[model samples]
Target: MAIKPSKGFIYLLIVAVFVFGVPSEAHAEPSYAKYGRAAMQETANRYPDANIIDYKYEGHFETSGARNEERFRLWLRGSGGEFGVRVHVYVAADTGQVRNVELEEIAR
Candidate 1:
């Protein structure tokens, strides 16, 4: 008698590769709350009427294509209800740029 792999087992193996095999650096990076401060200031400058109470980098990921490009969502609040604004902010591994921003609402 010979042992055979189950269909479910093979599927799990494939998922594991996509999930843990690749490094995060290949796709995107994480962002924190402090990183959103600058965008808040800019928004404040652009839209004086709209008061930017808070903002944060939701996450970072490559969009459209790699090219080291990425879009990070910034949770924002002001005149409008709570929502997110995706912005183009890509920082290299050691670029000293905003990696990610933590959400204040969910911080606690």
Candidate 2:
């Protein structure tokens, strides 16, 4: 006898591909490599002696109706100890100029 595919099996495969193939917003990485670099540069400027071990893009937030900022968390190792810092890279949406950078230490 010849083997044949079931209708249920075919439907399941289609459903699996539809669900798994689509990229979700939460799982997608932002196209903000330049912004991330700018944030890292600012972090380096602030902690000249500290070495950045790792970093991640937390996400972007709207500061105001007209302003939006990209947030990043940087892990650093210094002579004192290992610590994390949050960097807020503010940029103008219209002109794309870096407005300001705010750094805050993350408590362990």
Say which candidate scores most in lDDT. 2
Clashes of each: 10, 0
Candidate 2 C-alpha lDDT tens digits along 38-91: 999999999999999999999978788667899999999998899999999888
> Which window of 10 residues has the lowest lDDT sum in candidate 1?
99-108
Tens-place lDDT digits, model 1, residues 48-107:
554444444445454433223333444555565555555554444445364432222322
Among the numbered candidates, top TM-score falls to: 2
Error of 1 at 65 (Å): 11
Supply the TM-score for candidate 1: 0.35
